[model samples]
Target: MQAQIEILASLQTVDREIREQTGRKQRLLEDLRVTERQIQAKKGEIDALSAAWSEREKLRVEKDRVFQDEGKKAMDKRMRMSRIKNAKELQALQREIELMRLGNGELEEELIKIMQEIDAIRAQIQTKESEMAAMQEEWQKKQDELQVEINGIDAAVSEASTRRQTIASQVTGDLISRYELIFSRRGGTAVVEVAGGICQGCYMNVPPQLWNEIIRNEKVHLCPSCQRILFVKPATE
Candidate 1:
């Protein structure tokens, strides 16, 4: 019975450590996911800014083309004005030329505004790109470090798992099965030490007769309240 108790206790300890290490690995994995998302979001921001810049650039280019076309029309009309002989015809031609010139000025003004907007958008895009690059670098470094930590935890968990298997093999089949069942149902604590005639597993007092049996340590006992296998440590002199 003492041998069996020792085996179960050892198994429980390993199981607890495995659970803890597994939890740590899960948390680290979540952190890694969040870190990756942050990098992606930053990249998305830069993409949106770049798209805006491209649209502005296209508008500027189209406006520039229209401005040049209008300027040529104004120049051509001015040259035709000197060939008119009739005063009324000359006045009409001059009015037409002035209208063309005014139209050209409006086009130039609109093109200038478009160019300014394009320049501003370009500057903003450049800044965002730089920021994204830096953010990616920072996140990648963090990911690498986190990965190393996660790998170490995985190795530890694997080692503990092997140890647990070895301990389980040393115990009888029925006892091992009972321990596993209790471990699963009792939150990884299948064995506990009794003290002061109390079922330490549930902090409830055991029957005095049962406590006496547990103290004997000649046979395994279960806490009636919590149904956990109980043992009593010998008094240290």
Candidate 2:
């Protein structure tokens, strides 16, 4: 019975270690996913910026075409004014020319503003694209490294599991079941050493009588407060 209890304690220890490793693996996997999403979001931002720049370029080109057409129309009207002989016709033609010139000036200012905006947009797009590319490369490298780590941890977990199974096989079924029940209810720690007259699992002080019983090591003892199996460590040589 004593040997079986010791075996059960060892199995629980192995199971606890396995749980810790499994938690670490889960966290690493979550980190990998977050990195992937960050990379994807950066790429989407770059794409949206590029699209905006393209649209601005198209608008700038269209504005310049309209400005050129207005200028041409104004010049043609000016040429026609030279052939007019009547005073009334000449004055009216002059007025029309002035109005056309003012319209052209306004169009020119608007076109200049559009060109400046396009230049600014282009610069911004270039910066964002460069940043996105660098981030993607970094993310990919990190993901690959994590994948290698995950594979290594998976192999280790498998080995630990096998070791745990072997340890469990050495214990009686009743003791194994009892340990598992305690572990399930107490966060994977069923057995704890009684050190310095306290349960190491919960740091609770053991009663005088229970402490003495634990020191005998003749049978399995449980902490009344935390319900963890208690064992006494041998004195150091």
Q: Using Cα atoms with residue i matched to residue i, what is each candidate's TM-score against the true structure?
A: 0.79, 0.83
Query: Lowest-lDDT window of 10 residues in candidate 1?
Result: 212-221
lDDT of 2 by residue, 1-237 (tens): 456667877888789888888999999889878877887887788788778878888988898899899999999999998899999999999999999999989989998897888888788878877887887788789888988998988898999999998998888657778788999999998988888898999999999999988777777788999998888766899
Clash count, predicted structure 1: 0
Off by over 4 Å in 2: 54-58, 184-187, 212-220, 234-237
Off by over 4 Å in 1: 181-187, 197-228
The TM-score of predicted model 1 comes to 0.79
Candidate 2 TM-score over all chains jointly:
0.83
lDDT of each: 0.85, 0.85
- The alpha-carbon deviation from the true structure for residue 118 of candidate 1, after best TM-score superposition, in angstroms, is 2.6
Candidate 2 whole-model C-alpha lDDT, 0 to 1: 0.85
- RMSD to the native, candidate 2? 2.8
Q: What are the clashing pairs of model 1? A: none
